[model samples]
Target: MSYQHYRLEELARLVQGELVGQADLCLQGLASLELAEPQHIAFVNADKYVEQAKVSKAGALIVTPELQQQLDTHQNFIVVANPYLAFAILTHVFERKHTQTGIESTAQIHPSAIISESAYIGHYVVVGENCVVGDKTIIQSHSKIDDFVEIGKECFIDSHVTITGEAKIADRVRIHANTVIGSEGFGFAPYQGKWHRIAQLGSVQIGNDVRIGSNCSIDRGALDDTILEHGVIIDNLVQIAHNVKVGANTAIAAKCGIAGSTIIGKNCILAGACGVSGHLSIADNVTLTGMSMVTKSISEPGTYSSGTGALPNAQWKRAVIRFRQLADVPLTQLQKRLDHMQTQIESLESTLKLRK
Candidate 1:
């Protein structure tokens, strides 16, 4: 990939940072302070990294104005209020150099499929009959888009992704590699002493700007649609069960399992390995800590947590015994206190009557 030079002032404006050094200095790419070359740009967010920034061979560095005074300013500097944020912006600029563009000739697109001319179909991809591939959507290698699937414009379906039949994915959605969408949910009924399979006829409806990470499984609804609202971001190895309705902008971390028919509210954050029970309603803005087992509905927006931390075996045994005894001890103490208070009240009432 050919490196593109960006002016220091242009980079500062792109990241919304104030420029302090020579604005006309050209930065080719971004690199770590220690590894930066003359064509690359580096950043120093803390005093600890200032030494590396000073010795770096990079043409320019992004740093806070306070830290710039401590370092060698021989190389041009872009002074930003937040150097970390500026670094994040420059990372994207450098990463775009490796991005793929246009369709490959070896891509296996079905004749019946309505793929937009602007879409990029990569190698060994299979687009099934009656599918609609939207404008500027890139379907990478080994991806299988099943029949009746609709992918909206500007979406990035990464390599080895599988979108099963009737799945509807909206605009600007990004699905990482090996993620399975619209698979059959776990639904069964006991009929005549045998387990009868319940057909999962409903499809998955994914909203715009949603990002699903690698190896995630989103099961199709059993009877109604399994819906993920706009801007919802899900991490790797997450299992979203049948009929699960996740509200807009809710971010769920890796290894979380949301059971069937659970309605998770908007802007909620479910941390890694958290298990949410079926048919429960989780209120908005609720944050579930890592490894939490949510077995009931959470109506309030406040942070709630359950699960005991690990301790030494001997200490844990003693703690368990005390925990069991607490129920009886509290009642016994309350009864003794109530009896003493009653006796005092009677003596006070008798004295009051005598005085009257």
Candidate 2:
């Protein structure tokens, strides 16, 4: 395995940071402050971590301009406005350079499929008829592509993944291992004693820069295509049901399940284990915290949280009992009446003050 080495001056230019160290210093990898070696670079994101930087064995550090005073004078530094962001930029420098492993002989490709000359189709991979695989796209081993599917440029489709239902994926999209795209939605009509199946006729449309993690199931639509706009990131084990439209730049964390026809607006964040019911519209810039269960539509942009955080066992049990007791009471009606009486009393007081 060959690692790419970059000089300090080159890394500084790449991250747009000011280098205050030997320009000729060569770095091979990026590591944490504690684990970094002489050949690797580390980062200090906050002032609180300055003490650790003092003891770190890292050859160089990415630090903000403000932290320069606290950073060790003996250590080399790359100064930037945001140390963490600069560190992220430097990560690309050390990323694995993907060598195009030209199409494997064992791969099965239909004659009608238009696979770019630059694309890499791994062993046992299947490309169906009328499919279009664009430039530099890598479809790893054992992956299956259904008929008429269009995967755009620079996409990465990992091993054992299945893309069916004539899905159209745009540039720079990444579908991790074992994920399924455009699978038939769960549509059924309740008959006398059974469920009659409704054929899912639509497909899926994934925009540019979308990242889908492993084991995710994005169901095809019943009428319209289930869509994921550009810059959308989905974590592992998420279930996106039929006809869902996830807006651009939205991030959905692990174990989330969104039912059919839900439109999640742009810049939204759905934290881990969140569940959104069918037919709900969540406005842009909204955030659903971890373990939240959303049943109603959110019309405004804000951070929303549901479900109780961890509590002591005895207290949680008592809280649960109280909740049950409240369900049995007419507390809502009483509260309304009390609110009306308070309004009346305030009106009387205002009238009395005017007379005085």
Model 1, which residues run further than 4 Å from truth?
Answer: 32-39, 42-84, 97-105, 310-356
Q: Which candidate is the best by lDDT?
A: 2
> What C-alpha lDDT do the candidate models reach, one value each?
0.89, 0.94
Give per-model TM-scores.
Answer: 0.81, 0.93
Across 1-356, the per-residue lDDT of candidate 1 in tens digits comes to: 67688888888888877776678887788888888887778888899987777778888878888888888645477788888888887787767622456668877777899998888889989889899999889898999999999999999999999999499999999999999999999899998899989999999999999999999999999989999999999999999999999999999999999999999999999988999999999999999988899999999896777787789999999999988887667787979999999999999999999999
Q: Clashing residue pairs in candidate 2, if any?
A: none
Q: Give the C-alpha lDDT of model 1.
A: 0.89
* Cα lDDT for residue 73, candidate 1: 49
